[model samples]
Target: MSDRTPNPPSSQSRRLYQMTRGALIILPLSIAVVPWGILAGSLAVEAGLFDFQAQAVSALVFAGSVQLVGMGLIKAGATLSTLLLTTLFLTSRHLLYSATMRTRISHLPLHQRLLLGFLLTDELFAVSSHQTRKEFDFWYAFGAGFSFYLVWQLASLSGIVLGQSIPDLDQYGLDFAVAATFIAIVLPSVKKLSVLVTVIIALLLSVLFSVQGIEGGIILSSLIAMTIGYAISIVRKEPL
Candidate 1:
């Protein structure tokens, strides 16, 4: 075992210097995400929030699915606890994302690490994992994540203003954007039956609990699904 860090190849360094690589890598997904952000903003506004509220949630939450779910819950006037639980559940996948990134990013300064954590989204994760790079550059990830973050905020702002003016943006079918984006994320990772089972179980449990009008159903379902998946992994000595 050696304490010294291995140097990345010169080609990897050259790839890092290619300023447009990260942007190019993220462009295709950004189109999907922008529509989803707009949908979230429009939905939030239609749910009776102030324009600032729509914009604030987009800027602060930054997780598209969680924002959409939170907007729905808010429209229903769900309890604060229910809202919290659902938001937590929606963002629970980030725990795994953060854990996976830790080995690559732990050497960074605390502030930089925090920024990356804040900017971590499904699209950014997909772009990062899909790209084949010999070494991880924080800037490369930052470029991809930052572009996504900026585009989403702008799209949300656009929708907020449009919702105020039109009040009929729902006909545009923007709701499909986030769901489509999710499929794009999962399709790449379903290389194993266990992984598929985990997804099915989570969805099934959530629906079952929702049908029963169970408070915190999303969280309960997600937690149980994760637990079952973990047990399966341990039994098989393989990751789901």
Candidate 2:
């Protein structure tokens, strides 16, 4: 053997490596969320939401789909109770997501845990979940989540600022970008036969519902498809 001493990595180098890896993992995925944020901000303004209300919706509310639906209901003159019920319905899935991650993050301080809850978007959760190595790295999760949070908030704010200038944003069909982004996210995960079947069923249901203009049908289809997938797994005696 050679007489050279092999030094382990420095603490600074390891921390930097983790942070960089975590941020890189989520940054690309966050591009999918940018259009939704812009659309939410611009639509809020066009829907006659006051500046402060829009801020509350984007900053405090933080759930993109829920906020969009809530803003639309508000614009349509829906009652406060109606908006509350609808938003709750739209975001009910978050309860399940939070519960799933509870054990993993239980060691974090209370404040950091609260922050994680706030930043736990679908994309963030997906990325962080796949990061098996960083499960216990609070700073790594923070780096990924905080970077995504900044992009979303800044994009929404920018859209709000530019909404007044571009009164005809709908004419550009920006919603298509958000739809395409979701498709891109889903397509990569269509590997297993069960997952493939579930996706096909969900797509068919979504198309039918969209053609019928059935409000909330997409969400309903998701629930139904997931249940079907679970039943399939049981029939195969496979764990989900």
Candidate 3:
């Protein structure tokens, strides 16, 4: 018997492996979003939206933070323009996410890219971006993103079912899962000094903005931190 190295996996097998790995690797983060999804649905119901309306928001918006904040603005009787602007501000981060993956995904067909854009979320961006750094795989990214979307839909449905029966579900602090999940995703990627500084600044600004009762503070802080981080990188790259 000859002892020989095994042949490399076929392209088809490699795609299947990455897709399966993507789905499985994203399970923990997908689970982490369950509570956030539930909260979004419950909050929508609590804000005087019909059950179908809540479900529609979850289905169409597909963004937990935007849905939650939009519901709050609705409850507060915000103007239509205010609602639209707030939503745009909250979801603008997705533009950055898309830009980060543009080089990798540019070759995909328009329909597939649209599907990916629709499925993209904070958690999916975190997981898929991490995976992309190791090896680029469209099937893997699609699998991870689609799985998370399914879990989110089911979780939101459960919330809608319970929203009427359980009063003040939001007061239970289940929303903490959102922050915890983001922390888990972020801490692992803060390898450089610039990244660490960005994280710290974002955290501090978030808390300060919250205490000051500023709307959209979280997104504002994120934008500021990212800008500063980019500047730091540029400066580091320049010759003294």
Candidate 4:
């Protein structure tokens, strides 16, 4: 036998490394999300919701925009049917995320696929879909997703508990954190002119929607932009 020794890390060392790296990576990312959670929590309190109820919604629904819209509707005294319809419209983007992910994650068992689908939020999808390692596995994605979910719920709960004690966030420019994080995550994926055009169109539409007082501006803008982008691709005979 050859005299070479294996260089594998010990189990304890690997666990420590994963935990440390996960914390380091996740903490900053979690900070970026804190503002949105704070806004959600503040709004929940303003809507006459209890802390527990707000926390429950954050934990269960787990979609930021949808949660915000739902809270808004509740505050407006919207009927159940209106609330349900608004939520469906707001969350319809998940269908696209699910369809795209199915091709990548289809080899997994039914239960695993179902669980993954439930955990698939915008941030989780952004991180997991772009993983390039040959050894990357569903467990890694799951770990990231679970960690994010926990952090988000905790942040929202803290915000609810500490609502108003937090100073004027708008004056402090906290809202930019989410957009900055999104840009950081998405910039790497723009490999073609078509993709660039799609992003630009989406941003423009988002601005226009905001100007026009459209509710759920980002979602509406993204849907319109994606549709237009696909149409442009078809006209130009470009592959998606």
Candidate 5:
């Protein structure tokens, strides 16, 4: 064995420590996310999945909205091709996320960036992107991602285990949890009037589409709203 002593945390380690601390700070913010997980579990069970299978989706996929969409498609007897297409449309926003994050974590190795990309959810990205501290590093992202991942999985499992007992989610307003979580994630990102306007427009479009009984109403609304938002931002020359 080599006789070299292990060095204390270097600059990279210090940065990781800051990132971890940041993760700790934001972990509790995920309380708003639990209900969505619960809904996913319930939907999974309702779609003929066993509790373990439902729980596995939570632990593996961990995207609440996508889970719901997938379940709906499964219920409709969608083919694998259709399901993959739908999932791609729903998750296309990650392409934008990857582009933006490239600048933020550029100093990290490619493998680390890839790992972080897997954990990049709306909530974690929203919080971490605003971090200006140089010390904030991969650990911070990891902490946030890992915590959210674990809690989401557990909450989903709980829902799966108890979905049979809980017959009326609408009565409990649990279905709204997904919306609430999205709102919570979004509110912090609004820093200007342009952003606020975009959000309002998105909401209006979403409501209109939902009222019209559009399939994939939320996704449709998001795309319309984002398109409108992008147009307004471009017209105004707003710096994103």
Candidate 6:
């Protein structure tokens, strides 16, 4: 036998490895989020927010969909109460994300849990959920989330600065990049029949409700889709 024994990786090195792995795994989606972040910042500026205020919204709110909707509401002269209620409704989806992740993160300390909650974006959720429980690590999640956060901040700043110069930035349809990226990410994981069926039905329902001009139609469709998906999974005795 050889006399030399290999040294184990140090804690710091291990943490760095996990963090780097997470960030790399999330890089594609993070890149997709850049245009969405820029759109949010530009919309904020167009809605009459100062550059600093627009950046503040991005840094503080950090929810792309909500920030977009909130800016639309602001442009429409929505009341404060209406904006607040809409924000609450839009963000309610995070509750589901939290519940789904609770089992994985329950053992973490309070501060870590809080930080995780704060950093939990839809993209991060999708990335983390794809990992098996055995592969999940807090540092991994943090690396992914923090990197996305930094990207969003920089993207938003770019938009704020450039928005003033661009005559019609929204006309370029930048949001399509965000949608396309999410579709690519989600499609790979829809290997299960139940998931496939649920996604189809959800798409149909969302389109039908939106076409009908139903209030909160997208949210309603999501709730119904989740319920149906759960029932189908139970009936089929398959994991979802």
Best by TM-score: 6
Off by over 4 Å in 4: 1-27, 131-136, 163-167, 231-240
Candidate 2 whole-model C-alpha lDDT, 0 to 1: 0.74
Give the TM-scores of the predictions, in the order they appear. Answer: 0.66, 0.74, 0.77, 0.76, 0.70, 0.81
**Residues 12-80, model 5: lDDT tens digits:** 675577667756655655666676777788889988988778888887777877898998888788999
Q: Which candidate number maximizes lDDT? A: 6
> Which lDDT tens digits does candidate 2 get at residues 1-240?
232335656655666766777687776656656777777888789789876677667888888888778878888999999999988887877776677677777778999898888988776676565434334576677777778888778778877887855334466565565466457667787756677778988989989998999877766887788788777877877654
Clashing pairs in 3: none
lDDT digits (tens) for residues 98-196 of candidate 4: 776776788888887877787888776766666553433566566666777777887788779887665466775755765776787778888766678
Report the Cα lDDT for residue 48, model 1: 92
lDDT by residue (106-205, candidate 3, tens digit) is 7789988888889888777877775554366678888888888888889888889888553454665655665676677789988777788899889899
- The model with the greater lDDT, 4 or 6, is 6
Native-to-model Cα distance after best TM-score fit, residue 198 in candidate 6, in Å: 2.0
Clashing pairs in 2: none
Which of the two, 3 or 5, has more TM-score? 3
Rank the models by TM-score, top first.
6, 3, 4, 2, 5, 1
Cα RMSD of all models vs. native, in order, equals: 5.6, 5.0, 4.7, 4.5, 5.7, 4.2
Better of 2 and 3 by TM-score: 3
What TM-score quantifies how close candidate 3 is to the native fold?
0.77
| Candidate 6, pairs of clashing residues | none
Using lDDT as the yardstick, the better of models 1 and 6 is: 6
Lowest summed lDDT over 10 consecutive residues: which window, candidate 1? 1-10
In model 2, where do residues sit more than 4 Å from their true spots? 1-16, 47-53, 130-137, 166-192
User: Candidate 1: deviation at residue 233, Å?
Assistant: 9.0
